[model samples]
Target: MANEQTSRKVAIIGTGVIGNGWITRFLANGFDVVAFDPADGAETRARQSIDHAWESVEQLGLHEDASRDRLTFVSSLEEAVLDADLIQENVPERTELKQNVLAEIDQFAKPTAIIGSSTSGIKPTELQEKMKYPERFVVAHPFNPVYLLPLVEIVGGEETTKEFEQQAYAFYESASMKPMIIENEIEGFVADRLMEALWREALHLVNDGIATTEEVDKAITYGAGLRWAQMGPFMTFHLAGGQEGMRHMLKQFGPALKLPWTKLEAPELTEELQERVIAGCETHAGDRSVAELERQRNEFLVKLIDLVEDYWP
Candidate 1:
């Protein structure tokens, strides 16, 4: 049992959507998880979410032998962080709130413990300033449905040492994740910025009445998204040129670059537009409850991963 326990110990300081996802990912990888959240019924919700996520992980054939006996839920942050080898924070995306929470957790966590934040925007430097041992803290941002997605972005803060960042990378790798070390801090890191760019254009198109929400979804899901799942845009274009590759493809399409591209401007979140967007999603989602949608999503993700592993292996 002690040998089984040596994989890693993870403490989650929040039990919201992101926190629940983190717990699922850690537990699915055989890490002992202790979580603390202040919200009413947070523990129950987190447990249910983890159960559902684990069902998905099991369906994906990930870590069949690790039982769920290692999970624990506590009522206090300190209780969760005290003995954790890695403390992953998924608190609200507020600088002050994160600062206060980290300051408190730093008091009790072991000196060698690595602190990681799931913050999508706030830089690690801002969050670490409130910690007594900033050297141990870094940003470990993961995509949603972290249990299935393998990519994690590791970004170091002001006082974070290279050794600490490397450890974070190794930890993520050990969990079977692909960790990308961010060279510097920037708003939304790398992937989110690309997503935001496409999102901005999506909104623009909808506002201009060029396409419906469903149409946009079809445009991607049935088209570019298929290719994107296998290879990114640049690589897809590179393959498009046959033996010519990226250079020839770029040279051929380079002339069209002078044409007016997307303005890349964010649309105003007007009340009408917001309602329309909500209604559009509701229409697209039909009557599926959040849980139902999550299950379907997990199934699709598992299939996608299986296909990729086979094709790319």
Candidate 2:
């Protein structure tokens, strides 16, 4: 018999960075998680990563005392999916691969199970077509370090029913996530499109030698990001325009939008550019292991959340 106290049985089918993050998130939220991965020694790696993530969650006061016992990792994908209420697929981003994996899982998943893809850019419709029960699948994409971030974008495919989408939205909210449901299935969804635009311009600036990686990071972190942490872009701009609001700001600065701008093109990941980016990051993040940096980032995020909660309350 399933544990009645467990909110849901979540199966994470890939114990990579994103998969492990999902495991921590579900477990922290009182979900019983069964994780699967085909990679050699994946169970050990997943357990280590989850333990580390839980340690940070504990430090940040995000996890309950019993969260550690709620998480369990399974060896086989079938075992992971068995009797799960929700299936979060964090497999590598590849069309053919995703198609194959979803097809295989569809055979075993319960009819009522909702399968969500953690894809950053793939359209839900494309992935759903390969499934036996298309309407059961949707995109429940989360940002990196899912345990800390609250935003989960919920997108429905063409075959996705309103009822299923609503259930998904409620499920995320119940797990303490702020889920925004997209009305239509579009490529890149919402946040990724915004990020791609910013990324394109950032890359253009970097390639043109206008700013170094550290300089770009500072420009956002020190200026816009501080406000963004508290409010969204439009809300911040609303305050910027005083009583006049967004319309006034648009009238004042909209003309500058016509200036020669970056072409919305993703640059090839050339060896030179990759090496420069990696080296620059290493230089900027001196003397810290990946684990250490993640811990520090989570701590800062928790402090920011606490400040907002107190001030806004």
Candidate 3:
């Protein structure tokens, strides 16, 4: 499953936030990138994003030949993927649009090219339903600021092969990413569902006036977030069992799973609620611009990843 070429070509089919992020990571790994987005001034915007992010990427350790000169923003989807060896589709999340675009990519991309979707929740089964070569497709979901984060969850559909899964994992690893393959096809995958549940509960708290946004942020960044960075919930719980291990831990706190302390359903997003949420977020953001916040996040995340590697490996 090793890539034979010294520099692979990557095609970004939708140049939105996630697509640009993928481009950033690929270029930092010395991949020749061809991107297509219908929006006006997309090429210039993508170049600016790469320039802004390259400093942090360099801090994280860039490939020897990595350069912004490697990226080529094309005019159409066909033009982007036609000669590419790998395609990362980042279009809108609507079902039909994804299916149609994947079908188009399959038609254009080289037969050997494996296509990956930057979908957060959509299933590979649905996304690959209309593709001619479904085996060459998989979901390569990455968190925001893709150049910084090392986690890329790879999930395959029913038609996807084990070989393709390994190939997909290797492709992301070429960029030095940590790729974890989902053994089974589950809706919302893993991390996203965890996030969705937390978001739903956070929304409930805000809507009920139980906790401010700042409190919610503190509840995480100062608490479970730190533990979750290096160890997952299960392992943490095992340690909490205090020498008895996970079996005993489950017997102790498992009953709380049935408690009514949490609400999973999302609260109604009325205008008033939306305003409250927005105001709270803005209050937390303070005078920091979006770019500034991104830089801060990327820098810290790079350091945190290094720390986690030391702890685990």
Candidate 4:
């Protein structure tokens, strides 16, 4: 349902996988998007991703003005962010590259426009270090297939202000996102740390020849992953305590935490291990290419989100 243009113009700095996710989400929300990337074929790849994602986006629902035609792939950073109300940087994770690029975006974008970064590793404090108006810069990290997932982690730098964080919350919320603001500036902010622990254990299991990748995946999908879809681990555990909830369960299970039942450190990723893991994944995936897998995953996400959104807290 394309209609008259809206004022929520978004400037996407890169057209990588994550960048296209943001572009698709913005367009699905009926925002005018202007994207730029120095890499060759960036625009074509981004547009193709949007086209694929828009098929599912349409299946769920479309904003009144959401259209593929609303996307403008500019040739330069200055031109891309010139009239944007919000500038989302999706460049590589290198600190020097991000600082240099953000400094450039800060110079060109409107002073009032929030220059957000999609850094999942680098902290906002490090990212905003070179910006002229650092206070206006905030970390707006999103997961893969950003158009489907509702969680976006917002972190503030040393120079970032609470006002800008609040502005980011408002912007993401308007786009049908769940914006989680992190007060502390720790590396790997929240979700990644939790995932890293689980990932590290999974790697150890494979390294020790205890479990295959398929077994690891089934352990999650058939067990905890189902619970995680509706509520978090804490809430799930709270309900696991019979009538007493978390307090009773913690009292009964807390003592077992001292046992050496798991490993936290990631096993060294040797070449053989890497090959084994890849082959295992290929076996599970059968004959699908990366593009096909992404399409399948995005299609599933569209229906899963529509099916489960009403259960969110």
Candidate 5:
């Protein structure tokens, strides 16, 4: 699929964090963006968020025609999606709410337009059930700070067409993203499932008073996180197996899989555990506001992205 005139315009249905991230990414890629959010001061907040993130995207490299002025805030969802080639839905995670929004988007968006949901856990089939044009829908789940992070897990539902999925892949690739097409539809897809497993373990550790949140954060920051930043878990373990690779590693460590080292379910979010986790994080963060922390993280990711490109197999 080639980039056509229609693909140059995108509509963002919500102006929350994920929506704003999508807006920034589309704008930075030189796409004309039309945004609709009924919440008061949405346009102003989105503009501010973009302004805050503009420097990072510039360092990451902007398209020749990329300009903040290309964005337009529309008054209605229909107005936003009417001329858009891609309509991204980033409303809250509530199932019924998302279904209603997607229904409206499907009703308004052009038949050729692709609709993507930033749902982290919901299956594409469930999200597209209420849509009249379900075949055009896909779950395009992305991580936080979507502008810098290249990974976007693209999953199509049972009703989704292969042609549209290919078009969606090309569209996301054109935006300077690494879009991975997942063949099967599953809740939480891949990345989030792996992350959720770790999250449950982390919560269990805190609940059992095994470690503070800061300690858990450090364990990742200095250990597995570094390796994961370059090669994923599989590749890292492949190296661990030395010349034999995964075969030897699996044979050596296979029995450990049945050990009780990890918990499958999340611990209860009791008030004491919650306060401890919160307090520990606040202590670690100290005086750095979230914006400040985000700036630091952006700087780190930009450099890391370059390194990943240089070393990626």
Candidate 6:
């Protein structure tokens, strides 16, 4: 379906993994995209990425007007954002770099254009501080494979207006995304914070010699990961309490919270530990290239998403 909202033009400031994913998604949803990246061969790399991901998006379905030809690479940021309805900043994750880039975007983009940052950890307040029109700025954090993942966390800063947030929500929804408006701003937002906690424990498991990287992956891949794919943590646990649901679950397992079964702090990435993790992953990957693994994952996700939609609330 095409976007019903007024935003039909989107500008992407960087052409890295996430930026290219956004381009693919916008094009899939029948939006014209303009991109600007200074690196040599950036255009070539982005085109290749879009080509590679096209098969999966095609499987997911595309709007009648969606086409790779709709994407245009511009020479500068000013040229990219001058006429855009929404500008997505996906530059490097450094705070100073992002702040500087966003300032330039704010200066060049139309005043009514919504400025979104694909920052995973930084709060919207900090990122919007340098923008002249801070009310239009937001932290639009998205997961990896942005085109495939529908959940986008929209966190507002002190300067962000409710009107802009609502417009942002509708804009992403037009692209077939589930835009989650986070009421409070925080580092890492909501989903990343949850993933970071599990990440810390996974690192500890590998560091303590209790499990290899592959083993830890299996623990999730064959276990919690499956359940998480369906109902998520809270609902999964609710079902675990049997007929009574979460109320009974708390009474039965709440005491275990004090058992210290998991570590919250991440282990130091020592040279030896790094090598073990690298070796373990390489061993498990077993000669398949990253591109090949990505292709396999995309195929599985396309099918999984079809099934998951029937179960989503």
- Model 4: per-residue Cα lDDT over 1-313, one tens digit each: 3344334899999889999999999999898899999999988899888888988878878888778899999999999999998999999889999999999999999888988899987999888888889998899889877998889999999999899889888888778789999999898999898888899999999999999999998888755775576556654554555455455556676556566679643455555754554455445545655455555545765676676567643
What TM-score goes with each of the models? 0.81, 0.80, 0.81, 0.83, 0.82, 0.84
Off by over 4 Å in 6: 265-313
Question: Residue 124 lDDT in model 6?
Answer: 90
Using lDDT as the measure, the top candidate is 6
Q: lDDT of candidate 5 vs native?
A: 0.85
TM-score-best of 1 and 2: 1
lDDT of 6 by residue, 1-313 (tens): 6555667999999999999999999999999999999999999999999999999899999988899999999999999999999999999999999999999999999999999999998989999888899999989988889999999999999999999999899888898899999999877889998998889889999999999998998787655675566455654555565555455555677666666688753455455754554455445555665455555655766787677568643
With candidate 4 superimposed using the best TM-score fit, by how many Å does residue 104's alpha carbon deviate from the native?
0.4
List pairs with backbone clashes in candidate 1: none
Best candidate per TM-score, number? 6
| 39-89 per-residue lDDT for model 5 (tens digits) | 999999999999999999999888887999999999999999999999999
Off by over 4 Å in 3: 1-7, 264-313
Superposed Cα deviation of residue 258, candidate 1 (Å): 2.0
| lDDT, candidate 1, 65-132, per-residue tens | 35577789998888999999999988899999999998888888999999899999899999999789
In angstroms, how far off is 178's CA in candidate 2?
1.0
In model 6, which range of ten residues has the least summed lDDT? 274-283
| Candidate 3 vs 5: which has more TM-score | 5
Candidate 2 — which pairs collide?
Answer: none
Residues forming the 10-long window of minimal summed lDDT in candidate 1: 238-247
lDDT of 1 at 75: 81
RMSD of candidate 3 to the truth, in angstroms, is: 12.2
Residue 43 error for model 6, in Å? Answer: 0.7
Residue 197 CA displacement from its true place in model 4, Å: 0.9
What are the Cα lDDT values of the candidates?
A: 0.80, 0.76, 0.82, 0.82, 0.85, 0.85
TM-score of 5: 0.82
